[model samples]
Target: MSGADQATRERLAEEIRSLRARRERLVDELVQSSGPGDSGDASQELQGGDEVAAIDERIAELEKLRAGRIDVQGVDPGTEVVLRFSDGSTQTFKVVAIPEEVLAGEEDITVTSDSPLGLALAHGQQGETVRYPTPDGAVEVEVLSIRRPS
Candidate 1:
């Protein structure tokens, strides 16, 4: 495995641990609230349930990612890139190692490492133009700048 692949595995494992802890906490909260006659705030319970479900989904995704081959090179989570579209419109996006991060609704626009744009960006260097296939067609984009994830 390459350094990037090992690094990605470590990061995914860390995220899984953190998410499992969070899921535990959410479950604990729900337990404390109990149900209808158990002095539970139904609204809070409902919200907590929703959060728990989301956490579970993320955990599953991360686990699958950790089990797979990590060949998405040159881009790790938090890697930022500025891309110039064919229309000359430039946009900055933070590339995440997994879809879980993007689903977390980060402040900056985010893309998964497996995404077409993300994969294309990962293999390209600064000032290089890369093409990604979209349902519409192949979209050509130029990488204006790349900030490696910390």
Candidate 2:
């Protein structure tokens, strides 16, 4: 596994832990509602219980992935690249070994390590040009820079 891949796995595992906490809280609530002598609306509680169980199952799957993680490594600490998509749109991003900063009211875009673009960017060097095959012909882009996630 690559260093970058290892870091990404660790980061993802942390995120899974956070989500698991939420799922566990919901499970506790469901267990309490399912206890005997409860005269409340059991149907709604049962629905919620099902949802919580599903989420817990999902978290468990994530945990399994974390345990058997494989990743790309040895990425330089100063890699940055500009991605030009097929829609004539472009964005610059850094291949960091950590999660991006949280923004207020802004959605986070987590680029998967398995994605073509992300993988290409991961192997790219500064000033290198990479061409990606898209549904509409091909998209060409240049690597402006590279950097660590820090």
lDDT of 2: 0.57
| Per-residue lDDT over 1-150 for candidate 1, one digit per residue giving the tens place of the 0 to 100 score | 233356567777898999999999889878987856633587778889999999999888777777764556546667888989888899898876655444444645787777888777767899898988999999998999988865
lDDT of 2 by residue, 1-150 (tens): 234365547665787878778877877777776756544658768778778778777777666555654444435333445655446566765443323221223222334344455666667777787766558766677766556455
TM-score, one value per model: 0.52, 0.44
In the predicted model 1, the residue pairs found to clash are none
Ten contiguous residues with the weakest lDDT in model 1:
99-108
Q: Give the clash count for each candidate.
A: 0, 13
On the 0 to 100 scale, the lDDT of residue 83 in model 2 is 57
